[model samples]
Target: MRLSLKVWRQSNKEAAGGFEDYKLDNVSPDMSFLEMFDVLNEQLIEEGKEPVAFDHDCREGICGMCSMYINGRPHGPLRGVTTCQLHMRSFKDGDTIVVEPWRAQAFPVIKDLVVDRDAFDRVISAGGFISVNTGNAQDANSLPVPKEAADDAFAAAACIGCGACVAACKNASAMLFVSAKISQLALLPQGQAERSIRAEKMVAQMDAEGFGACTNTGACSAECPKEISLENIARMNREYIGAKFSSSAV
Candidate 1:
Protein backbone atom coordinates (compact mmCIF):
# COMPACT_ATOMS: atom_id res chain seq x y z
CA MET A 1 0.00 0.00 0.00
CA ARG A 2 1.04 3.59 -0.54
CA LEU A 3 0.48 6.25 2.15
CA SER A 4 1.15 9.85 3.00
CA LEU A 5 2.68 10.77 6.34
CA LYS A 6 2.71 14.21 7.91
CA VAL A 7 5.27 13.91 10.73
CA TRP A 8 6.66 16.50 13.08
CA ARG A 9 10.27 17.50 12.50
CA GLN A 10 12.35 19.33 15.09
CA SER A 11 16.13 19.62 15.15
CA ASN A 12 16.28 20.22 18.90
CA LYS A 13 14.21 21.24 21.87
CA GLU A 14 14.80 24.94 21.14
CA ALA A 15 14.39 24.61 17.38
CA ALA A 16 11.16 25.58 15.68
CA GLY A 17 9.26 22.50 14.56
CA GLY A 18 6.62 21.76 11.94
CA PHE A 19 5.05 18.94 9.98
CA GLU A 20 6.91 17.47 7.01
CA ASP A 21 5.12 15.27 4.55
CA TYR A 22 6.42 12.19 2.78
CA LYS A 23 4.93 9.50 0.59
CA LEU A 24 5.72 5.83 1.20
CA ASP A 25 5.14 2.95 -1.15
CA ASN A 26 5.20 -0.87 -0.78
CA VAL A 27 4.11 -0.74 2.87
CA SER A 28 2.99 -4.13 4.09
CA PRO A 29 -0.22 -4.43 6.04
CA ASP A 30 1.55 -6.71 8.51
CA MET A 31 4.32 -4.21 9.16
CA SER A 32 4.27 -2.65 12.58
CA PHE A 33 4.07 1.15 12.75
CA LEU A 34 7.73 1.49 13.61
CA GLU A 35 8.64 -0.80 10.72
CA MET A 36 6.85 1.56 8.39
CA PHE A 37 8.96 4.40 9.70
CA ASP A 38 12.05 2.25 9.24
CA VAL A 39 11.17 1.87 5.58
CA LEU A 40 10.72 5.62 5.25
CA ASN A 41 14.02 6.33 7.00
CA GLU A 42 15.83 3.88 4.74
CA GLN A 43 14.45 5.57 1.64
CA LEU A 44 15.57 9.00 2.90
CA ILE A 45 19.04 7.69 3.81
CA GLU A 46 19.44 6.15 0.36
CA GLU A 47 18.79 9.62 -1.08
CA GLY A 48 21.43 11.23 1.23
CA LYS A 49 18.69 13.06 3.14
CA GLU A 50 18.49 13.12 6.93
CA PRO A 51 16.17 10.31 8.02
CA VAL A 52 13.20 10.97 10.24
CA ALA A 53 14.03 10.35 13.88
CA PHE A 54 11.76 8.41 16.25
CA ASP A 55 12.21 6.56 19.52
CA HIS A 56 11.85 2.77 19.62
CA ASP A 57 13.33 -0.18 21.51
CA CYS A 58 12.19 -3.70 22.27
CA ARG A 59 9.88 -3.44 19.23
CA GLU A 60 7.72 -6.04 20.96
CA GLY A 61 5.97 -3.20 22.87
CA ILE A 62 7.48 -3.90 26.29
CA CYS A 63 9.80 -0.88 26.20
CA GLY A 64 7.16 1.86 25.79
CA MET A 65 9.64 3.86 23.74
CA CYS A 66 7.65 3.98 20.48
CA SER A 67 5.85 7.21 21.23
CA MET A 68 4.05 8.64 18.23
CA TYR A 69 0.85 10.63 18.42
CA ILE A 70 -0.75 9.32 15.24
CA ASN A 71 -3.87 10.93 13.85
CA GLY A 72 -4.36 12.87 17.10
CA ARG A 73 -4.31 9.74 19.28
CA PRO A 74 -1.44 8.39 21.29
CA HIS A 75 -0.30 5.10 19.70
CA GLY A 76 -2.81 5.41 16.88
CA PRO A 77 -6.48 4.44 17.20
CA LEU A 78 -5.87 1.08 18.82
CA ARG A 79 -7.00 0.15 22.31
CA GLY A 80 -4.55 -1.34 24.83
CA VAL A 81 -1.59 -1.23 22.41
CA THR A 82 1.59 0.84 22.02
CA THR A 83 2.87 2.34 18.80
CA CYS A 84 5.34 -0.50 18.32
CA GLN A 85 2.43 -2.91 18.48
CA LEU A 86 0.33 -0.94 16.00
CA HIS A 87 0.27 -2.45 12.53
CA MET A 88 -0.10 -0.71 9.21
CA ARG A 89 -3.30 -2.65 8.50
CA SER A 90 -5.04 -0.22 10.83
CA PHE A 91 -4.88 2.24 7.95
CA LYS A 92 -5.91 2.04 4.31
CA ASP A 93 -4.22 2.49 0.98
CA GLY A 94 -3.75 6.08 -0.11
CA ASP A 95 -4.38 7.32 3.42
CA THR A 96 -2.81 10.35 5.06
CA ILE A 97 -1.52 9.89 8.61
CA VAL A 98 -0.50 12.68 10.93
CA VAL A 99 2.15 11.87 13.54
CA GLU A 100 3.52 14.01 16.32
CA PRO A 101 5.36 13.61 19.60
CA TRP A 102 3.91 13.82 23.08
CA ARG A 103 2.87 17.39 23.77
CA ALA A 104 3.56 18.46 27.33
CA GLN A 105 5.85 20.98 28.97
CA ALA A 106 7.47 18.22 31.00
CA PHE A 107 8.18 16.23 27.83
CA PRO A 108 9.86 18.71 25.53
CA VAL A 109 10.92 17.33 22.18
CA ILE A 110 14.61 16.48 22.00
CA LYS A 111 14.34 15.86 18.25
CA ASP A 112 11.85 14.55 15.74
CA LEU A 113 9.32 12.35 17.54
CA VAL A 114 11.57 12.00 20.61
CA VAL A 115 10.83 13.76 23.90
CA ASP A 116 12.85 13.90 27.11
CA ARG A 117 10.88 11.75 29.54
CA ASP A 118 13.45 11.92 32.33
CA ALA A 119 10.86 13.88 34.25
CA PHE A 120 9.16 10.54 34.90
CA ASP A 121 12.37 9.15 36.30
CA ARG A 122 12.70 12.15 38.60
CA VAL A 123 9.13 11.70 39.84
CA ILE A 124 9.79 8.03 40.54
CA SER A 125 13.00 8.89 42.36
CA ALA A 126 11.15 11.31 44.58
CA GLY A 127 9.24 8.44 46.19
CA GLY A 128 8.05 5.52 44.05
CA PHE A 129 10.18 2.95 45.88
CA ILE A 130 10.26 0.93 49.08
CA SER A 131 13.60 1.58 50.75
CA VAL A 132 13.06 -0.98 53.52
CA ASN A 133 15.16 -4.07 53.03
CA THR A 134 13.01 -7.14 53.59
CA GLY A 135 15.98 -9.49 53.20
CA ASN A 136 16.06 -12.31 50.67
CA ALA A 137 13.06 -13.79 48.95
CA GLN A 138 10.56 -15.44 51.25
CA ASP A 139 8.18 -18.31 50.55
CA ALA A 140 5.13 -17.07 48.67
CA ASN A 141 2.86 -18.67 51.27
CA SER A 142 4.73 -17.07 54.13
CA LEU A 143 2.96 -13.77 53.53
CA PRO A 144 -0.35 -14.55 51.96
CA VAL A 145 -1.57 -11.44 50.17
CA PRO A 146 -5.31 -11.01 49.66
CA LYS A 147 -6.13 -12.29 46.19
CA GLU A 148 -7.96 -9.07 45.22
CA ALA A 149 -5.06 -6.84 46.31
CA ALA A 150 -2.59 -9.03 44.46
CA ASP A 151 -4.62 -8.84 41.27
CA ASP A 152 -5.05 -5.08 41.52
CA ALA A 153 -1.36 -4.62 42.23
CA PHE A 154 -0.49 -6.78 39.23
CA ALA A 155 -2.77 -4.72 36.98
CA ALA A 156 -1.25 -1.47 38.18
CA ALA A 157 2.23 -2.89 37.71
CA ALA A 158 1.46 -3.39 34.01
CA CYS A 159 1.88 0.33 33.42
CA ILE A 160 4.82 0.85 31.04
CA GLY A 161 5.21 4.60 31.74
CA CYS A 162 4.61 5.35 28.05
CA GLY A 163 3.55 8.97 28.71
CA ALA A 164 0.38 8.34 26.69
CA CYS A 165 -1.54 9.48 29.74
CA VAL A 166 0.17 12.84 29.60
CA ALA A 167 -0.26 13.10 25.86
CA ALA A 168 -3.96 12.19 25.93
CA CYS A 169 -4.90 14.56 28.70
CA LYS A 170 -6.29 17.98 27.82
CA ASN A 171 -4.18 19.36 30.65
CA ALA A 172 -1.23 17.10 29.90
CA SER A 173 -1.56 15.61 33.39
CA ALA A 174 0.67 12.77 34.55
CA MET A 175 -1.76 11.77 37.29
CA LEU A 176 -2.65 8.43 35.72
CA PHE A 177 0.98 7.39 35.33
CA VAL A 178 1.87 8.59 38.83
CA SER A 179 -1.19 6.91 40.34
CA ALA A 180 -0.46 3.58 38.69
CA LYS A 181 3.05 3.65 40.14
CA ILE A 182 1.67 4.42 43.59
CA SER A 183 -1.12 1.82 43.41
CA GLN A 184 1.16 -1.00 42.31
CA LEU A 185 3.06 -0.55 45.56
CA ALA A 186 0.38 0.68 47.95
CA LEU A 187 -1.71 -2.40 47.28
CA LEU A 188 1.15 -4.70 48.15
CA PRO A 189 2.34 -5.38 51.71
CA GLN A 190 5.91 -5.00 50.48
CA GLY A 191 5.19 -1.32 49.81
CA GLN A 192 3.55 -0.55 53.16
CA ALA A 193 6.58 1.03 54.78
CA GLU A 194 6.77 3.92 52.31
CA ARG A 195 3.04 4.38 51.69
CA SER A 196 2.43 7.79 53.15
CA ILE A 197 5.76 9.30 52.20
CA ARG A 198 5.59 7.78 48.73
CA ALA A 199 2.35 9.54 47.95
CA GLU A 200 3.54 12.85 49.36
CA LYS A 201 6.92 13.03 47.69
CA MET A 202 5.82 11.67 44.33
CA VAL A 203 2.89 14.05 44.08
CA ALA A 204 5.11 16.96 45.07
CA GLN A 205 7.67 15.99 42.48
CA MET A 206 4.96 15.56 39.82
CA ASP A 207 3.87 19.13 40.46
CA ALA A 208 7.47 20.36 40.39
CA GLU A 209 7.98 18.68 37.04
CA GLY A 210 5.54 21.12 35.39
CA PHE A 211 2.93 18.44 34.64
CA GLY A 212 -0.56 19.83 34.43
CA ALA A 213 -3.29 19.24 37.00
CA CYS A 214 -5.77 16.39 36.51
CA THR A 215 -9.37 17.48 36.13
CA ASN A 216 -10.87 13.97 36.45
CA THR A 217 -11.30 13.70 32.69
CA GLY A 218 -10.98 10.04 31.71
CA ALA A 219 -8.92 10.65 28.57
CA CYS A 220 -5.71 9.46 30.19
CA SER A 221 -7.05 6.02 31.04
CA ALA A 222 -8.91 5.72 27.76
CA GLU A 223 -5.71 6.27 25.81
CA CYS A 224 -3.33 4.41 28.13
CA PRO A 225 -1.85 1.39 26.35
CA LYS A 226 -2.14 -0.58 29.59
CA GLU A 227 -5.67 0.72 30.20
CA ILE A 228 -4.63 1.62 33.76
CA SER A 229 -7.89 2.43 35.50
CA LEU A 230 -9.08 5.81 36.73
CA GLU A 231 -9.59 4.12 40.08
CA ASN A 232 -5.82 4.31 40.58
CA ILE A 233 -6.06 8.07 40.39
CA ALA A 234 -8.77 8.00 43.02
CA ARG A 235 -6.63 5.78 45.21
CA MET A 236 -3.73 8.18 44.78
CA ASN A 237 -5.86 11.09 45.87
CA ARG A 238 -6.85 9.23 49.00
CA GLU A 239 -3.25 8.30 49.68
CA TYR A 240 -2.12 11.90 49.26
CA ILE A 241 -4.85 13.20 51.57
CA GLY A 242 -4.14 10.61 54.24
CA ALA A 243 -0.45 11.34 54.06
CA LYS A 244 -1.01 15.08 54.46
CA PHE A 245 -3.30 14.55 57.45
CA SER A 246 -0.87 12.17 59.10
CA SER A 247 1.99 14.62 58.68
CA SER A 248 -0.05 17.55 60.01
CA ALA A 249 -1.19 15.57 63.04
CA VAL A 250 2.40 14.98 64.12
Candidate 2:
Protein backbone atom coordinates (compact mmCIF):
# COMPACT_ATOMS: atom_id res chain seq x y z
CA MET A 1 0.00 0.00 0.00
CA ARG A 2 1.02 3.62 -0.42
CA LEU A 3 0.47 6.41 2.07
CA SER A 4 1.43 9.99 2.74
CA LEU A 5 2.63 10.79 6.24
CA LYS A 6 2.56 14.29 7.69
CA VAL A 7 4.77 13.74 10.72
CA TRP A 8 5.92 16.42 13.14
CA ARG A 9 9.65 16.86 13.51
CA GLN A 10 11.73 18.79 16.01
CA SER A 11 15.46 18.81 16.69
CA ASN A 12 15.26 19.54 20.42
CA LYS A 13 13.15 21.18 23.12
CA GLU A 14 14.23 24.65 22.01
CA ALA A 15 13.76 23.94 18.30
CA ALA A 16 10.65 25.00 16.44
CA GLY A 17 8.88 21.99 14.94
CA GLY A 18 6.64 21.48 11.95
CA PHE A 19 5.14 18.70 9.91
CA GLU A 20 7.23 17.12 7.16
CA ASP A 21 5.56 15.11 4.45
CA TYR A 22 6.90 11.74 3.33
CA LYS A 23 5.61 9.22 0.89
CA LEU A 24 5.78 5.52 1.64
CA ASP A 25 5.01 2.92 -0.96
CA ASN A 26 4.85 -0.85 -0.84
CA VAL A 27 3.97 -0.81 2.84
CA SER A 28 2.97 -4.18 4.21
CA PRO A 29 -0.39 -4.39 5.93
CA ASP A 30 0.90 -6.99 8.33
CA MET A 31 3.64 -4.72 9.66
CA SER A 32 2.93 -2.94 12.94
CA PHE A 33 2.84 0.86 12.79
CA LEU A 34 6.22 1.10 14.49
CA GLU A 35 7.63 -1.39 11.99
CA MET A 36 6.40 0.84 9.20
CA PHE A 37 8.11 3.77 10.86
CA ASP A 38 11.29 1.72 11.07
CA VAL A 39 11.19 1.17 7.33
CA LEU A 40 10.67 4.88 6.76
CA ASN A 41 13.61 5.66 9.02
CA GLU A 42 15.83 3.31 7.03
CA GLN A 43 14.83 5.02 3.81
CA LEU A 44 15.56 8.47 5.25
CA ILE A 45 18.95 7.32 6.58
CA GLU A 46 19.90 6.23 3.07
CA GLU A 47 19.02 9.73 1.83
CA GLY A 48 21.05 11.46 4.59
CA LYS A 49 17.92 12.93 6.22
CA GLU A 50 17.21 12.86 9.93
CA PRO A 51 14.60 10.24 10.66
CA VAL A 52 11.39 11.13 12.45
CA ALA A 53 11.71 10.73 16.22
CA PHE A 54 9.04 8.68 18.03
CA ASP A 55 9.03 6.95 21.35
CA HIS A 56 8.75 3.14 21.24
CA ASP A 57 10.09 0.22 23.23
CA CYS A 58 8.83 -3.28 23.94
CA ARG A 59 6.81 -3.13 20.73
CA GLU A 60 4.70 -5.89 22.28
CA GLY A 61 2.33 -3.10 23.51
CA ILE A 62 3.12 -3.62 27.19
CA CYS A 63 5.12 -0.42 27.45
CA GLY A 64 3.24 2.87 27.19
CA MET A 65 6.17 4.60 25.47
CA CYS A 66 4.66 4.46 21.98
CA SER A 67 2.49 7.54 22.50
CA MET A 68 1.07 9.38 19.52
CA TYR A 69 -2.05 11.09 18.26
CA ILE A 70 -2.63 9.32 14.94
CA ASN A 71 -5.12 10.74 12.45
CA GLY A 72 -6.81 12.67 15.32
CA ARG A 73 -7.14 9.62 17.58
CA PRO A 74 -4.98 8.70 20.51
CA HIS A 75 -3.84 5.39 18.95
CA GLY A 76 -5.26 5.63 15.50
CA PRO A 77 -8.80 4.33 14.94
CA LEU A 78 -8.39 1.14 16.91
CA ARG A 79 -9.94 0.66 20.34
CA GLY A 80 -8.03 -0.84 23.28
CA VAL A 81 -4.69 -0.82 21.41
CA THR A 82 -1.62 1.40 21.37
CA THR A 83 0.23 2.85 18.37
CA CYS A 84 2.84 0.06 18.21
CA GLN A 85 0.05 -2.47 17.98
CA LEU A 86 -1.81 -0.66 15.18
CA HIS A 87 -1.18 -2.18 11.75
CA MET A 88 -0.97 -0.54 8.37
CA ARG A 89 -3.96 -2.58 7.20
CA SER A 90 -6.19 -0.24 9.16
CA PHE A 91 -5.73 2.30 6.41
CA LYS A 92 -6.28 2.00 2.69
CA ASP A 93 -3.79 2.74 -0.03
CA GLY A 94 -3.38 6.44 -0.93
CA ASP A 95 -4.43 7.47 2.53
CA THR A 96 -2.98 10.59 4.11
CA ILE A 97 -2.15 10.31 7.82
CA VAL A 98 -1.34 13.09 10.26
CA VAL A 99 0.76 12.02 13.21
CA GLU A 100 1.47 14.22 16.18
CA PRO A 101 2.77 13.94 19.73
CA TRP A 102 0.59 13.84 22.84
CA ARG A 103 -0.65 17.36 23.63
CA ALA A 104 -0.88 18.56 27.23
CA GLN A 105 0.51 21.34 29.34
CA ALA A 106 1.78 18.69 31.75
CA PHE A 107 3.51 16.85 28.93
CA PRO A 108 6.27 18.85 27.31
CA VAL A 109 7.41 17.92 23.80
CA ILE A 110 10.80 16.28 24.00
CA LYS A 111 11.03 15.74 20.27
CA ASP A 112 8.82 14.91 17.33
CA LEU A 113 6.36 12.39 18.79
CA VAL A 114 7.94 12.13 22.18
CA VAL A 115 6.56 14.06 25.15
CA ASP A 116 7.97 14.34 28.65
CA ARG A 117 5.53 12.33 30.79
CA ASP A 118 7.41 12.84 33.99
CA ALA A 119 4.34 14.56 35.41
CA PHE A 120 2.79 11.13 35.73
CA ASP A 121 5.78 9.93 37.69
CA ARG A 122 5.48 12.90 39.99
CA VAL A 123 1.78 12.20 40.54
CA ILE A 124 2.55 8.63 41.49
CA SER A 125 5.38 9.69 43.73
CA ALA A 126 3.02 12.03 45.53
CA GLY A 127 1.06 9.14 47.07
CA GLY A 128 0.65 6.04 44.95
CA PHE A 129 1.87 3.48 47.47
CA ILE A 130 1.39 2.33 51.05
CA SER A 131 3.87 2.01 53.92
CA VAL A 132 3.87 -1.70 54.46
CA ASN A 133 6.25 -3.23 56.93
CA THR A 134 9.23 -5.22 55.65
CA GLY A 135 8.27 -8.84 55.20
CA ASN A 136 7.84 -11.60 52.65
CA ALA A 137 4.87 -11.34 50.30
CA GLN A 138 1.61 -12.02 52.13
CA ASP A 139 -0.19 -15.32 51.61
CA ALA A 140 -3.11 -15.25 49.19
CA ASN A 141 -5.66 -16.05 51.92
CA SER A 142 -4.17 -13.66 54.43
CA LEU A 143 -6.22 -10.72 53.25
CA PRO A 144 -9.07 -12.68 51.60
CA VAL A 145 -10.51 -9.87 49.53
CA PRO A 146 -14.01 -10.24 48.11
CA LYS A 147 -14.27 -11.40 44.52
CA GLU A 148 -15.92 -8.22 43.20
CA ALA A 149 -13.46 -5.98 44.99
CA ALA A 150 -10.50 -8.00 43.73
CA ASP A 151 -11.80 -7.86 40.17
CA ASP A 152 -12.41 -4.13 40.33
CA ALA A 153 -8.94 -3.48 41.68
CA PHE A 154 -7.38 -5.64 38.95
CA ALA A 155 -9.34 -3.78 36.31
CA ALA A 156 -8.16 -0.45 37.64
CA ALA A 157 -4.61 -1.79 37.75
CA ALA A 158 -4.81 -2.48 34.00
CA CYS A 159 -3.97 1.17 33.43
CA ILE A 160 -0.60 1.47 31.64
CA GLY A 161 -0.18 5.23 32.17
CA CYS A 162 -0.09 5.72 28.38
CA GLY A 163 -1.40 9.32 28.57
CA ALA A 164 -4.10 8.46 26.05
CA CYS A 165 -6.61 9.87 28.51
CA VAL A 166 -4.73 13.15 28.63
CA ALA A 167 -4.41 13.44 24.85
CA ALA A 168 -8.08 12.61 24.41
CA CYS A 169 -9.31 15.26 26.82
CA LYS A 170 -10.12 18.82 25.75
CA ASN A 171 -8.67 20.02 29.04
CA ALA A 172 -5.71 17.64 28.88
CA SER A 173 -6.70 16.44 32.32
CA ALA A 174 -4.94 13.55 34.06
CA MET A 175 -8.08 12.68 36.02
CA LEU A 176 -8.59 9.26 34.47
CA PHE A 177 -5.00 8.22 34.96
CA VAL A 178 -4.96 9.54 38.50
CA SER A 179 -8.34 8.01 39.26
CA ALA A 180 -7.20 4.59 38.10
CA LYS A 181 -4.12 4.80 40.26
CA ILE A 182 -6.21 5.84 43.26
CA SER A 183 -8.98 3.29 42.75
CA GLN A 184 -6.62 0.35 42.38
CA LEU A 185 -5.23 0.97 45.84
CA ALA A 186 -8.50 2.07 47.44
CA LEU A 187 -10.25 -1.22 46.69
CA LEU A 188 -7.83 -3.28 48.72
CA PRO A 189 -7.55 -3.73 52.46
CA GLN A 190 -3.82 -3.21 52.27
CA GLY A 191 -4.50 0.31 51.02
CA GLN A 192 -6.97 1.36 53.72
CA ALA A 193 -4.26 2.72 56.00
CA GLU A 194 -3.25 5.35 53.49
CA ARG A 195 -6.34 5.77 51.30
CA SER A 196 -7.37 9.29 52.34
CA ILE A 197 -3.86 10.62 52.40
CA ARG A 198 -3.14 9.00 49.03
CA ALA A 199 -6.10 10.68 47.40
CA GLU A 200 -5.34 14.08 48.92
CA LYS A 201 -1.66 14.10 48.00
CA MET A 202 -2.11 12.68 44.50
CA VAL A 203 -4.87 15.14 43.68
CA ALA A 204 -2.77 18.00 44.98
CA GLN A 205 0.18 16.91 42.90
CA MET A 206 -1.98 16.54 39.79
CA ASP A 207 -3.04 20.18 40.13
CA ALA A 208 0.53 21.30 40.83
CA GLU A 209 1.61 19.61 37.59
CA GLY A 210 -0.55 22.05 35.58
CA PHE A 211 -3.07 19.48 34.25
CA GLY A 212 -6.46 21.08 33.77
CA ALA A 213 -9.48 19.95 35.77
CA CYS A 214 -11.72 17.25 34.35
CA THR A 215 -15.03 18.54 32.97
CA ASN A 216 -16.74 15.10 32.87
CA THR A 217 -16.65 15.18 29.09
CA GLY A 218 -16.03 11.39 29.10
CA ALA A 219 -13.52 11.68 26.27
CA CYS A 220 -10.72 10.25 28.40
CA SER A 221 -12.31 6.86 28.99
CA ALA A 222 -13.55 6.70 25.39
CA GLU A 223 -10.00 7.01 24.05
CA CYS A 224 -8.34 5.01 26.81
CA PRO A 225 -6.56 1.98 25.34
CA LYS A 226 -7.13 0.10 28.57
CA GLU A 227 -10.77 1.23 28.68
CA ILE A 228 -10.31 2.20 32.29
CA SER A 229 -13.77 2.78 33.71
CA LEU A 230 -14.96 6.26 34.66
CA GLU A 231 -16.26 4.73 37.89
CA ASN A 232 -12.73 4.96 39.19
CA ILE A 233 -12.91 8.69 38.83
CA ALA A 234 -15.97 8.72 41.06
CA ARG A 235 -14.22 6.49 43.54
CA MET A 236 -11.27 8.85 43.71
CA ASN A 237 -13.63 11.73 44.26
CA ARG A 238 -15.33 9.94 47.15
CA GLU A 239 -11.95 9.31 48.70
CA TYR A 240 -10.82 12.88 48.24
CA ILE A 241 -13.95 14.34 49.78
CA GLY A 242 -13.60 12.06 52.77
CA ALA A 243 -10.06 13.26 53.26
CA LYS A 244 -11.07 16.93 53.40
CA PHE A 245 -12.22 16.89 57.03
CA SER A 246 -10.66 13.79 58.44
CA SER A 247 -10.82 13.44 62.19
CA SER A 248 -7.04 13.37 62.25
CA ALA A 249 -4.33 14.52 59.86
CA VAL A 250 -3.03 12.15 57.21
User: In order, what is each prediction's RMSD in angstroms?
Assistant: 1.3, 1.1
lDDT of 2 at 5: 95
TM-score of each prediction: 0.97, 0.97
> How well does model 2 score by local distance difference test?
0.92
Top lDDT prediction, candidate number: 1
Name the lDDT value of residue 6 in candidate 1: 98
Error of 2 at 41 (Å): 0.6
Write one digit per residue (lDDT tens) for candidate 1, span 77-138: 99999999999999999999999999999999999999999999999999899875568877
Model 2 residue-pair collision total? 0
Give candidate 2's TM-score. 0.97
**Cα lDDT tens digits for candidate 2, 120-222:** 9999999999888988988978888999999999999999999999999999999999999999999999998998889999999999999999899999999
